[model samples]
Target: MGDVGPYPWLRAVLAAFAEEVRGLGPVLDVGCGPGEVTAHLAGLGVDVSGVDLSPKMVEHARRLHPRLRFAVASATDLDLEPGSLGGILGWWSLFNLPREVLPEVLASFACALVPGGHALIGTHVGAGDVPRTEAYGGVPVTWTTHLWQPGELGELIVAAGLELTAQLQLPASGQLRPQVLISARRAPEIAPGR
Candidate 1:
């Protein structure tokens, strides 16, 4: 799955925010299917790790980028220490989840990040869930994509204790749906009564 439409833009956005990740600590690429984005972060000298629910994807990622770390893990339930990660990339991954689960997963993203950490989340912009029953490119595949309005996802990010920093909605070209990219930062710690 090469960059279909707004993928290059998405990558550019991540590249722009590299400093936020660098300042905090290591980065985690959740739902990192084949570790392409994770590898990109690693290439930028960001301490990064990739995690996917499928073991096959993990194996493939390891084979593709042997030097980078990859693991089979669910986004909703992460095996990470609190306040540990500096940045997270959920590129083209969050729309696969059901709406009910987004809060939990977003909270997990927040939990994994240190105070002032950053996250970049990408998804298709639309009203509701879209189920794809047929395979693509002669490969047997079935999946559902849950679209969201930018405001909807922004609310979730805020609810997860992250401050909304930027929301970029790129218009659709040809067959592609309009994509929304949200950048959020975990609030910095505060001393009591300061």
Candidate 2:
């Protein structure tokens, strides 16, 4: 996935998210495939790094974006420190996570984020799971693509203690399914004796 670049709408969403958390703290790109989006955020002046479950992917990302940081890690096992990240991105990356596990991951995101930090998630829009035996030029793989409706995903995000701030729904085109981009923000901290 060498700099395949993002869709126009995705670029806009990323730009906006980067602007929101530019100086708060570093951002983490969960499931960062090739670090393209990680590099994109860095170009926008947001401090960002990426992690992927596949060591091969992380290797490619590191080789491609040498200036950026990439690590081998799974979304399910991210041991993030509370109030550390300014933002977290799950851009088109969390579909493989089981439905039950996603909420826990979102909760982790909420806990890791600083007050006022944001989380941006992009996922295929639908209702069930699509099993796959191959992907990306027919590379042999075993995984399930779990599709979710906007409202269902939004409910999980809100339940994770983040406020839903924006949602963008895009229609299916070519081989791509309909997709939704949702952005949520952790509530800001309150002052003492306000």
Best by TM-score: 2
Q: Candidate 1: give the clashing pairs.
A: none
Model 2 root-mean-square deviation? 1.5
Q: Write the per-residue lDDT of candidate 2 for residues 22-67, one digit (tens) a residue.
A: 9999999999998999999999999999999999999999999999
TM-score, model 1 to reference: 0.91
Worst 10 residues of 1 by lDDT: 1-10
Residue 66 in candidate 1, Cα distance off native in Å: 0.8
The whole-model C-alpha lDDT of candidate 1 against the native structure comes to: 0.84
> What lDDT does candidate 2 reach at residue 148?
97
In model 1, the Cα lDDT at residue 146 comes to: 91
- Give the residue spans of candidate 1 off by over 4 A: 1-8, 191-194
The digit string of per-residue lDDT tens for model 1 on 1-194 reads: 22333467767776776867886798888888878888877777789998898899899999999999999888877867889889888888778887899898898888888988999898889997888876445666678989899998999999998999998898987877998889999998898998
